[model samples]
Target: MAGAGLKGARERRVRTGGIELCVAELGDADRPTVLLVHGYPDSKEVWSEVAVRLAEEFHVVLYDVRGHGRSTAPAPLRGGFTLEKLTDDFLAVADAVSPDRPVHLVGHDWGSVQSWEFVTVPRTEGRIASFTSLSGPSLDHFGHWIKSRMARPTPRRIGQLLGQGAKSWYVYLLQTPVLPELAWRGPLGKRWPKLLERVEKVPAGDYPTPSLPQDAATGAWLYRDNVRARLSRPRPDAFAHVPVQLITPTGDAFLSERLYDDLGTWVPELTRRTLPAKHWVPRTRPDQLSAWIGDFVRTHEEPATRAPRPVAEAAVRSGVRPEYAERFGGQLVLVTGAASGIGRATAFAFAEAGARVVAVDRDAEGAARTAEMARLIGAPEAWGEAVDVSDEQAMEKLAATVAAEYGIVDVLVNNAGIGLTGSFLETTSEEWKRVLDVNLWGVIHGCRIFGAQMAARGQGGHIVNTASAAAFQPSRALPAYNTSKAAVLMLSECLRAELAGRSIGVSAICPGIVNTNITATTRFAGVSDTAEEKRRQRKASRLYGLRNYPPEKVADAILGAVLHDRAVVPVTPEARGVHALSRLAPGALRALARWQPPA
Candidate 1:
């Protein structure tokens, strides 16, 4: 049976544990099955976005848990929502959907909690090829964690225990007899959707369904049935048999990052991914979830002949810094002007963090060299593309090719720019146009083309635009350069505000003066002869050499900005000083701008 507006989805009802489960299927039945599970107080619609994405390559399945969505709640639901019954529901669904093939299990929140149980139990070993867990921990693992911390009673462990205890305040309330049900049936249920939208930045849609009040009321037993029982008498033998991937939202308010500290002891084959998102990732970040789940399932699926796949070099590389590896690993990153200067260094930084890098530059050889070194540095894959960022059509083609070949870019660095130096009176219109085209319009094109893809993907990504300290610290000799960088800085701030709701981060990296080749090629507005221009270039390059700030440091700042979601970052000492001065003492900066540098 299919609802009229349910699109191409096929719906079925399966009787499991005396409850009729509402199940929906998509894509070809012959393909491997990917079963997506929703969390508490939510229905199958929670996975609608992610399910469609996965359906492109796999047989996608989604079902309401025992009492949520269209599924009928068990009579006298107090003890009916145990992990055992949940596992039974999973088995029934798997047997009905793909009896001969194991399913790839992906779950978020309470779904993850139950799926962890499914993966660890011996009965479901061959039925589950892999499991991807998000935002929820196994109650058994959580309980053991609590017991160990309490048993040890050390200061650090106590702090962790207390921190997690604070986060789990809702669990305590949920366990109370009629209070939770009454609240859910009252104003709380009606307001929950708005609350999720405001707090988690989840886009409004047909989620939390009309059945939310009853679903949440009946689902309270999920905590009552399993939490205390599993925690107090935890199973020591609860270790996962199938491959497991953990996707952690760094900004989740309900779960502490420290909860997974001992996860390795339980999961033998584990891959960890961290996202700069809030709790409801399936709703707010479905694209990223689907991408990760697809990759994990494809890697672990049983080949027709049971042949082993070769381990990838990126998987085994120890070059990535430990802090960055979890966040950037397997992510696609594109850097413009990556042939040299800060762009190349930034590309190398992301590559070293295990991202797949696409290096773009007008110089083909230099771009190729950067890509080659990026592969050696630890990128899972790297490519070089020769494109001028100032050309709109070239950038559009580049964006299409990158998406078709490398998947959507998770991080975009609009680092391509040029240098121009001259007084306002002497700078010709052509010189101003040249600088603005590359510096301002280049950033605009990158953001318009690539940033749109990121937003349309609905996964959320980060964009880094290379501005200069001249954006803030006005200078007499660098009028055109300052104006272009100022526009870039303002664009970044505006984009940051606009994209915050989309979970896309925009950062303006303003480095004062770095040891880069921009100075060697900087245009001198008033110089008429080639020799004079060369003399000016050498003089500027020599002056910058004396002040020598490495581009590598600027690269480090770029990565840090992405990690911290920083808006405007000043890299070098003088940059930071000038930024401070521009804000704290604007008149002083204006006075300093009046001083003319040697020609």
Candidate 2:
């Protein structure tokens, strides 16, 4: 029975394989079971809402994968997070949760990969009846995607370099023993918003970052084994037989929609669904997902009571419309900081793509100007509002008014953020708090307010937060800025964990400088009085000027990331390079950063 007032789902700690996992559950055990698996750096809570939805039809089981969320890390944390080990853990949990009955399994991001492996494995296949993958890729398929992209001509060299670089940063960081620990425990942890913010681009809602220590070493271990190793090793032979459903958000940033171009080759029985969501698909687009899932089960599943549908009905009966259709036309979009840069450009881009736009900014006149431009660009509706991004109460009220007037907010872009230049010592306490309050907390409030409504409505929506290139890289000069962004990044990650079950989409945008007016408004130590500070900003801007990209391009990237439910996206050449190199060689990067900028 669906209870009138259910408390928040409770967590159950259990050991599967060699690791302890924190599992969450809802509904009666006698019902059919749906097991939910979360992806990298996240835990079981992400599936809470989705679990609740599925509980209406089946018992829902959600658990933090080993090392993430409330899961206990194994000793020698680095070795425990491999795909192989995680796959085993999935099997273990499946056996414990539903040993006799086949499980309806669902996974997002990294969890999808594990679910794919679980259904394909010879031993585990018996326990799985259906598999749903959200924003996940087969390791082999992903590897091929990267390689094929890299094979392009010299003109595309920049894109290749950028991808390599974005990937490199984390790999480079993993090579170190102490730096990762220091980062998690030291100032890096405190200034997390700046350091991790840019990496948090999901479409729906963001991942939440509780201001505390989490055992990241375990999740980092998975990267060391898979990403660092280049995913070259053969995946187990058992993965081809799973009956799978794949949900790809159109706006995914890290893994492009193009990644699914050849997915059918690997998954013959795949049922593909597309949402105008981002990487945080579970949280932002839960209602949409729930409805979609209901439809999918009705259309694709063979009922136990009724004999399988007649061949004619099965083959010819109509199903959901193909994603390429014009149904996405005229969706309403509210983008913050929509005067110039990604906000303004994204507003216009949406107009070009047939979306009604609500462009909000502190610069009322500038927002109006952007609205005018959107109308000229063919928007069905373009409106402007003046609001300070850092004002949480204001945003809450704005969200309420928008919902009341527009009915539902299909998309929200928390894109207003400030940049900084100079060392941490140069940063004042007020400056640090201010940056975090705006860049980090701004996103938090937006998600809490809009996300709650989206969840209640059950239609599904997307949230995109603007982070920065500094999210994945640790720099001494821009410590305060980096810290705030990092916190923003972690915040998105946590939300991805908490909100997926509801199917709300969350994306964090991490972009390098793209010809924006941020520098003009930027407040930093030594900018006015300090000659050295002024010199750094000038030199840095000059260097960045070499890559003078348009905000429209970044906006396009945001749309792509959301549509495909990509978790992490790097939007600049420098950002890509920094991300990749840091992953491959962190010490070398640290040394390079320490090396005084070439005089």
Candidate 3:
């Protein structure tokens, strides 16, 4: 208990090349290491939160790069801040720190730029297991885009004004004769955070920016050399072989996200994430940032003997296979109304993850196609059956057959449903029954049959029901669809409460308008085959004015709910607004239902 991980970390000083870097060593040295590199005007203290969390599993190495923090900055610092020079500094640090093993590298802001260059270098290629770039662009691409865009008057004016024009005061003072060193060592000693606020526009309460004479000049020199193209450069294509993860902060005012638009083209193994934070995302969102890093490291950074093929090589040399959740592998997954759209996709996601998928749909061939995709994704087994989930006997028999063949059901996705688009007056009694039968009754049947056995056996399981944004906020044009989905939401909530003491979990997936075959399946009061009639139907659908998301994204959300035990999974931004509307003003929402195509 005394050596209870990083609760007892040791601090030390190490020489990386010419610089004496201050380093903190945490966790067991035998575990895979995480090299946390700090950015400009900041120190390794920024990674305190992340280090503490990762220390339970990883050997965390936090170091102040070069001139920043407690590191010694020798004379003639101008030539030492180039990207190549920074790469040398990182390589030196890694060699001194973890000489025997490949390390997982994570960096933010200026450190991200350094990590991007360091990981792709031929000499350091095998030394690094994976790289996580936070709030930094690919240097070559950023340089190219900036240079190309500066040719235009408007953009050049904006770029120069923000990057150099407004910063001339501080840049001048940093390059000044006598004032900088005296100012830093004297009255400006404790005012580095406030000074950075005025110059970098970072708020005082945000990330702390440490300052020193040599460090300021060395840090600024990176941009100076970049603008002048004075640094040794590798072709942008060099990074294509490296495994890179990018986390972009949407609220980062200084950097434009457009820099990563063509990122996939450069690094084929790129895993991109967008966080809702400022430029100093690592300091502000350490928990989320560290979680992503942990996942990347755990997945990729095994021992050298078990060194997984770089994702880039695995992608090109062979076909990339879908990775499955632990609950899905070789286990039975039931998907209802699997003939088309999200049902088809849910079956495929499970199959791709190596589950024995049972795809049931009223349409025989459609169900077969879903089953086929599961097989293509290397599922342990896949079965396609034509059965109406609303039919109790058919669902019971389907459940029995799956149990007989695949042991027990572990995951059940109730995605079978039909959509109706018309006002309450326009919707007939018969139409209401049909929609309810498929959407509400279908989920009820699946849960009752499969869930009973799962609860009886005392084996934990998951249930996913496909509802809609309309469930919470009724759409003016689709009363029947809204009512059916509303029932599904309540059903899931009630099931979750009943099964809470048991190990069973339930989720209601509320999706916004998805670009699936659902709209095509909407049955008009009278059937039409004429071109004009079809054109009018298409036009009405267009007037509905919904953002059509892809089926895959919705499927991902569904799977995420099961894996994470999330109660209500809302797919789109529209769904979020609907949930808020229902929460704040129910009366207003009900009144607005009279409005045509209420968004």
Write down the TM-score of every candidate.
0.77, 0.50, 0.50
What digit string (tens of lDDT, one per residue) describes model 2 on residues 1-599? 11111245545667766568766667777666778887755556556556667677666787777666666677776566666777778777777777767777888887886666676667765677778888877776666556655666465554664654574465578667677766766675565544333433232332443422364544656666676454554353534576777777765655666667767767767776666556666665554455445434434343662223234333222331233112233467889889887899888767665456889998999999998877766554578988887898898888888876654677778898887666677777788888887888888887888888776665567788888888877777678788888887778778877777767677878897778777655666645566665665566667656768888779878877766777778888878888788789888777766654442
List candidate 3 segments past 4 Å from native: 1-7, 147-218, 225-227, 230-241, 303-599
In candidate 1, which residue pairs clash?
none
Per-residue lDDT tens digits for candidate 1, residues 1-599, read 64222368999999988999999999989888999988988888888878888888899998999999888988889789999999999999999999998999999899999999999999998999999999999999999999999889999999999999899999999999899989999999989999988777677877768888999999999999999999999899999999999989877899999999999999999989898778888887765677678767877888772323235444545655666877887678999999999999999898878778999999999999999988877775799999999899999999999988777788999999999888999999888888999999999999989999887765579999999899998889889999999999999999999999788999999999899999898988887899999998998889889998889899989999998899999999999999999999999999999999888
lDDT digits (tens) for residues 1-599 of candidate 3:
11112246676777755778777788888888899987665677667767877887788998777777667764576666777877777777788778998888998877887777787668787789888888766577665555545656586455653553342355345545556656656666567766655443333442453444445445555555443452234355546455787777654656666667657766878776654345665544454566567766866776553424334432221332332333344456888878877888778777655466889999999888888767766554588889998898998998888766554676889889987666677677888888888889998999999998666544457889999999998666777888899999999999999997666899999988777777656765333355644664576567444555778788878878876789998898888887888999888788978787422
Which candidate wins on TM-score?
1
* lDDT score, candidate 2, position 464: 82
Identify the runs in model 1 with alpha carbons over 4 angstroms from their true place: 2-6, 303-318, 329-412, 422-425, 433-463, 468-521, 530-557, 564-599
Best by lDDT: 1
RMSD to the hidden true structure, all candidates:
5.5, 18.5, 14.7
Of the pair 1 and 3, which is ahead by lDDT? Answer: 1
Per-residue lDDT of 206 in model 3: 24
Which of the predicted structures, 1 or 3, would earn the higher TM-score when compared with the native? 1
Instruction: Supply candidate 1's per-residue lDDT for 415.
Output: 96
The global Cα lDDT (0 to 1) of model 3 is 0.70
Q: How many angstroms is residue 160 displaced in model 3 relative to the true structure, after the best TM-score fit?
A: 13
